[model samples]
Target: MLRLLYVMTLTVCCLPLIPGLGGVLLSAASYLPALGLNEPNLDGWHAMTSWPGSGTALQLSLFTGVTATLLAILMTFLILQRCWGTQGWNRIEKWLSPLLAMPHVAFAIGFALTFSPSGWLFRLFAALTGETEPYLWSLVQDSQGFGLILALAIKETPFLLLMSLSVLKQMQVDRLLTASRSLGYNASASWLKVVFPQWLTKMRFPIYAVLAYGMSVVDVAMILGPSSPSTFAVLVWQWFNDPDLTQVPRAAAGAIALFVACFGVLLLYRLAEYFLVKGWQSWQFSGSKTYSLPGKYLFGFVALLPVIIIPVLLVWSFALRWRFPSLWPTRTTTRFWEQEVGNLLELAANSLILGLVSASVALVFAIGCLEYRDKYHKSVPQLVIAIPMLIPQLSILFGIQIAIYMLPGQWHVPATIWAHILFAFPYVYLALDGPWHSFDQRLTQTARSLGHSAWKAWVSVKLPIVLPAILLAWAVGLSVSFAQYLPTQLLGAGRITTLTTEAVSLASGQDRRISAIYGLIQAFLPLVFFGIALAASRIADPQRRLARHADKQVSSNELISTKPNH
Candidate 1:
């Protein structure tokens, strides 16, 4: 049974990456036969390098992606240092789920509506100053990358916090704090010197995930990024959507470049974390507190912006007569909802089914893989799981599309669902990895010694023990599936539509009502999944209690059976 599970896990989670990578690699090198480019060439590479403003675009992408990712990490560390295991930490913990639940596209749209040139703030400025000259500003689509960086940073901070929570939990922050405090250090100083190094090490994976995500992000970048010299992922996305046949190879090359850039950034981040935190251990010993982070203020500001943004979006979605210089909507109607209701119903159904199916499948495979790893003392490589997580969606997706077309069937629902599964599996695997490794293995052995078969022991013991982690991984998978843009777009072949693509495409036209409806629905999917995860984790608390009760019963039964009267 265990061996079968091992094989099933391999088939479900790890094998698809071969075809995924192969398809992209072939197309990226211009060896695509379907497009009549049988002869491999460097033309695609040359085209990517020679494009107008390409260098500027790459620089802008780096600036926004790297800056936002690092800033979020720093903010996460500060928040943890000050608040972890403290009274204030509870409030932040409560907020983390909803913040993490908000979709990137939704957050980006709301951000623009709140801060852009024609946005609410500017209108307020016009009304207050009585200057109708309409001073020109284009911050929303500013040629520089400030808008993109700010939006990405805001969207990413919540994720970093959530990730930090997991790391902090594993680090035994309370014990470290107590130990350091006994050495005469201040509370903050104890955290900086003792807890941070361990936290940083555990945090490397999430940091890499963040960096890769920010660098490779397409939907968020499209909503808030500069237009004249767009980010690299956006540029690759445009190329993939280009109607011209000759541009496909260029798009493939761009995807390859994105993959490379993601890898390079992660490598650099690892080196930097090592140098600052690990190699220079002296800083932990000798340095005076030079860096005083405004952590509470940063959290307050970051948390406030999103709270304000959501209400503003709610107003825009209902407003019929909202225009410049108005503090509030002049007219309100459900007509926006009325107009979009039917389309949203269909899109919502599609999104729900996709998220559910993909998340469930990934969960099963993840559990199998982890169980197999425990029993056999072997496992899949970490990099295999992370490749899909780190790589940009647009880069490999076009090749996957071509591969789909080459398969003996037309694009269909199954293909789209499979694409989601492929993408969602990595997140599911990573989510399960920590808990699985940390699980107490002796419980399963004890169950087996009690005359339970291996399968029964696992079903009756291990599954119950890890059910919370399983559910959380499933939720993570669902969010990954819900936020999918490129895979659904390319694999669905435009016949199948999801909320993310709808939200992004409509956002291009600047119709806030229509876009808001889609954004709300997009945000709702993850919230629903997260809610389920939270509930399941709570409900599964019974398993632990039941196990303890059963163990007590077994001990009592044995004591009674061993009477001395015989």
Candidate 2:
């Protein structure tokens, strides 16, 4: 039964990638039978290559993807070099959950609200300068992709920070720091020379994840990217969504081009990692030359951007006509809320059910995999788990959708939920990997010696101890599920109406008010789940303490009973 369960879990969780990849390749090559294109040809390839300034779009995509990912990595390390194992670390930990919980879509919307030319910043500038003219600078949709880079950098930094915390914890940073200090190295030098190499080596998966996201992110790019010749992924998406049937080949070609782009970038990352970190062994051994980074100020700026943005979103949510040059809303009303309340409720319910179900399912499977790893001393290689995360969602979802059709069932909510779980599992698994591996096995052994069954030992000894991580993983999964755009759209066939799908579709219509409302509500879903996860973690900690106290009390009572009455 155990073996069967393990096989079933692997099949369900990791086996879909083959078909997903195969389907996309076949379709992109013009072999999709469902679309009645049986003869494979280079027409798709021609379309991909011959489009006007297509090369520029692809170049822009690569530049934005790599630069944003590198910037985020730099920011993450800076924050850790300064704040790890300090008082600020605790505060960062507290905020990390909320920050991670905020979906990319939500972050992009809030970013636009603050940084767009006609946004809150411009209003402030107008008020201070007494100039009726709003700022003319095109910050939001600038042709240079600066806004996209900054937005992605800010959004992905928290993810890298979270991953770094786990890696640093497992590395035993204190011992390393002490040894480096004994060797006469300062804090910054110690980190760079003694700690960074090892940390970066272990962080390959998360870094790949960041790269994949930056390279292929569609929703965020749509909001903040250049419109004249949008990012490659967005251009491909437009091709796919084109109403013309003949354009399917063009879209498929674009998807193929995107796949190549992502693959090339991944190769570049690996080469860079090898050259900079591993190949240069001399760098680690070189004499220390202290480098000073303004990490505190960098973190302050990153934090302050979101802080300023949230109020803008809230104010916009209630504004009826808060036009240009108004420091505050010219008129405010609750009507947006009242108008959206009913539809928002329905969307919220759909989003909540999908997020809760998918995250819960993924958590169960993650626990199973972790337990199997612990007992068997064999692990699912990180690359296998990272494939879904590191591959562009648009690149593979079409293939997966075709595979779903090949299955013996009609597409419905269950299929959509399953796709969400498939995507969410890797994240949930990654989130739990740190805690699960770090758990001491001796406690389980002690429980077993005290006559607890294996299952009982897990529940009473293991589960309680790692329950905090489980909750956090659940939140991570929930956020991933909530933020899903392409998977739900492709798999759900427009029947499943999550906040993301609604938000994206509404944004296409370019109604700022409607889009803002949807964006705020989309942000709210994960916030609610993370809030519950946070409270649950705190309550679980207290309960474990109480249980420990009760165990001690019982032991004392037994000792008293054994002694004489005096």
Candidate 3:
């Protein structure tokens, strides 16, 4: 049974990559049978290279991608360093779910609405200046892609922090901190020297995921990124959308270039980690200064940024007449919501269906993979599982779509769902990885000793123990599916109208009111699941229930003792 499940997992999760990558690579080589170009050549490469601003676009991608990733990691580490055991950690933990649930496109929509030229900040300035409007530049579509960098940094920090939570939990962080303090180190110095290196090593994969995302994201980049010469990913996306069928090779080459560039960034990260943590031992001892960041404030801002963003989205959605130089809406109505209610409901249903199906399938496959590894003491490679995440979506989607076209009948819905699973599986698996590794095996053994079969033992003991993690991973998978943009766009071929697709489409119109409606819907869908996941995790956790029961008993004892004294 385990072997069958292991086989099923590999087939479901990893088999798609073969054809996906193969098709893209073949297309990149200019071997387009559909275009009647039978011969493989470098024409596509030449065309892509010779395109105006192509080089600059790649450079822009690299700059924004690398810088954003570094900023997110720095923010994550600083927050973990300063707030991990503090009161601020509580707030940070409380907000991580909502922050993580915010889709990139939704966040970008709110961000643009708040920070654009005639946006809220500008209105604040205009009110002070006693002007209805003024000529002012804003971060939206900044030529340097700085706005995209900032947005990505702020958006991805929550993911990094969440990943760190699993790692820190396994490390016995309190013990490490106590031991470091006894060894003549303050909290700041101890965190920097004693904990930083180890955390970075464990954190390298999540960092790679962030870096890849920063480089390859299209929806967020489209909403806030520069337009003159867009990021390389945007360029490739445009190429794929070009009407000319013969232009497919150029798009393929560009995807290959993106794939290579992303790999380069990952390599750079590995080298930097190696050298910083292992190559230089002196830094571990050289830092005696109590240099720490204001991470409490940083996390508060991180938490607060979304607070402002969500309300901004909600207010914009209903504002019948919201002009500049006004903090509050002058007029508001629900007619917009009323008008789009049916359509939005359809989109929401489609999106919810996709998210649930994909996440559930991915969750089952992830459990099988982890269980296989536990039973057999061998597993699929981590690199294999992470390929979908680490590679650019555009790099594989084009080829996958073509392969779909080759199939008979309408495969659009199935293809789209498969694409979601392909992408969502990695995140789901990684989410479960930490908990699966940390699980104590003795409980499972004890169950087996009671004459339970292997499957029964797992279900009776191990499953309940890790139910919280499983639920959280399922939420992560659902959010991942909800956030998917390009897959639905290319694969669904207009037959499927997800909230994400609608949100991005509405956002493209620059209609703040309508865009806000979709953005709020898109953002809210995942938050509902995340809220459920958090609540369920807490309620389902045996340890938490025990602790609550113990507290109740202790309070009862104290009351009884105090009554006699009184």
| Model 3 deviation from the true structure expressed as Cα RMSD, one decimal place | 2.6
**Estimated TM-score per prediction?**
0.89, 0.94, 0.95
User: Where does model 3 exceed 4 Å of error?
Assistant: 129-131, 287-289, 547-566
Q: Model 2, stretches more than 4 Å misplaced?
A: 405-409, 542-566
The runs of at least 3 residues in candidate 1 whose Cα sits more than 4 Å from the true structure, single-residue gaps closed, are 12-14, 123-139, 289-292, 459-465, 543-566
| Range of the 10 consecutive residues with the lowest summed lDDT in candidate 2 | 1-10
lDDT of 3 by residue, 95-136 (tens): 888899999999999999988988877788888888887447
Ranking by TM-score: 3, 2, 1
Model 1: what TM-score? 0.89
- Of models 1 and 3, which has the larger TM-score? 3
Worst 10 residues of 1 by lDDT: 288-297
How many pairs of residues collide in each model?
Answer: 0, 0, 0
lDDT of 2: 0.84
Candidate achieving the largest TM-score = 3
